[model samples]
Target chain A: MIEILLSFSQATGIYSFMNSPWGWPVAESIHFFGLCLLVGTVGLFDLRMMGFAKEISLADLHRLVPAGVAGYSLNVVTGIMFLSTAPDQYIYNPAVQSKFFFMLIAGINMVFFYATTANEVKSGDAISRVLFRAKAIAAISLACWCAVIICGRLITYYRPPYHWCLWC
Target chain B: MPGSKLGLLKLETLARLEETALSTWMRESGFAFFSALTVHSLAMAFVVGINFAIALRLVGFAPRLEIAALSRFYSLHWYAAVFIFISGMALLLAYPAKALTNPVFYLKLAALTLGLLISRHFQATFFDRPKVTNDRRTINLAYVSVLLWVVTLTAGRFLAYTHNTLLASRYF
Candidate 1:
């Protein structure tokens, strides 16, 4: 897996750019900027559903989801850049593993929301059960994303023993 | 005081801060230092995220969305802002010289302060008027606010790199 990622990165020139003097920090900055965008948009949408800011229409706020999608795309690109640049440093890191785990949960939560509660929740007032489900989904999504952010920070700040896996 | 003399005086004070129990503990204890750093990042993301949303709105992303109602998110924004302050002060206390002596740190401070002041301006205007519409001035302010936030985030990232002195007490 590491070889494949490195080969792909080298083939795509991402490795060279990331190895350059300013490349890593630049990518890190953009990676974070993308996250802020996601939090601002999709995260805000979640807050709306979870009964925080009750003023904005759900359908209207959904207009900003495209921007959140765009932000997620940016993070994926930069994330790939980082992963492919140094697979060895990241792949074994438990913090990175935890970060990926949170992202996976968030992804599943999003698809589930869109598949199940999205329509009912977005169409103004919904049945009580649907509202409850939507709130649960929103809370899960927010928690997952927050956990992802914490894991990302931990990747830089701490490198635990036997970091190849979390339980070890 | 002479310029070099003043510089030395500042360094002397910073060195004293570095030797303090709290600062020493924060630096030595990974849990304390990294927890503060993580909270700082979390708070920064929320604050910047909310600001970006507001800026996008004012720049005409959601044309019909009520600006006043949207400003309700300001409640969350300010709460996150307070976390930024507490975490930020903790970070600064840990390494007083690392941030204080850096010019980039000052740039970040200026940008963040101006960006937040713009947040206040938006919240005040939108809440006061029932049907406030975006004008040329408002749109321009939105653009400026966006730019200021960009500078603030970028400068924050660069602060790690641009610091000339990591610990002032080393020289003292």
Candidate 2:
């Protein structure tokens, strides 16, 4: 699977663009901005779900989630650019793998939130059972996202000792 | 002392700060610098993230949301800001000359100051109100705040690429 992904990335022309003087730095800036958007909107919504700001209606808070989703989309685009530019750096790095793992967990947590707890909270009155579940999902989502950030930061520190392949 | 003289003296003091034991420890200690960097990045996410949410709300991204209610995040923002400030200081102390000499460093500081001021202004004008009026001025302030925060993040990132000197006392 890694081999296939590596080959697919190397086949793209983004490598030269990414290797350009301004490419990486510009992408990094956008990546950080996207992170702020994701964490700010989605994370705030999660906090509300966990009963942090009870006065605000959950429906109102949910309005911010689309912005968070937009941030996630931005990151996905930049992240693919990064991966295509240097597939080996990410493919072989344990830190990147860990980041993917955390992202997967966060994705699952999101699904759980939407599928199960979202409706209960949307009613604007958090019953005890729904509140407990919401709190648990919220905590998990926060932790997973935090781990994803930490692991992403650690990727450079844990670069794989491998030569770059032109076409994999 | 004249203004320029005072500036030189302050730079001299900052240069000396690099030679302090704490600064030396921060630089030489294994993992300490890295840990501080991690903390700084994480805290930054929270600070920038919450601020972005607030900015979006002000600009009418979520029209149904009450601006006053969003002020609940003010405490979290401050907490993250405090964390970022301390960790950032550790980073600066570790290489005072590197940051102090870099033009980008000053830009980052300036941007951060402007961002903070905008944040305070938001708190006073919008958050403190019982009902936030989504006027043009409020939206403009929100737009400016978001732009300043993005500038702060970009300048901060560029600091790594733009610094020329590692230690001011030895070089200067």
DockQ numbers for every candidate?
0.58, 0.50
Tell me what TM-score chain B of candidate 2 gets against the true chain B.
0.85
Candidate 1, residue A68: the lDDT equals 86
* Interface RMSD for each of the candidates: 3.1, 3.3
**Pairs that clash in candidate 2:** none
Docking class of 1: medium
Give me the runs in candidate 2 sitting further than 4 Å from their true place: A1-12, A162-168, B1-19, B167-172
The numbered model that scores best in DockQ is 1
State in Å the error of residue B103, model 2: 0.9
Per-prediction fnat? 0.71, 0.69
Tell me the TM-score of chain B in each candidate: 0.93, 0.85
lDDT of 2 by residue, A1-168 (tens): 556655665577566667777778778888888988989988898888777877777888889989899999989988998886677688778888888989999999899888998987887666898889999999899888888888888887776765332233
Q: Residue A49 lDDT in model 1? A: 93
lDDT of 1 by residue, B11-69 (tens): 88998999999988887888888899889988899999988888899999977667787
Instruction: Compose the digit string of candidate 1's lDDT tens values, residues A30-128.
Output: 898999999999999999999987878988888888888888998999999999998877877888998999999999999999998888888886999
Residue A97 lDDT, candidate 1, scale 0-100: 91
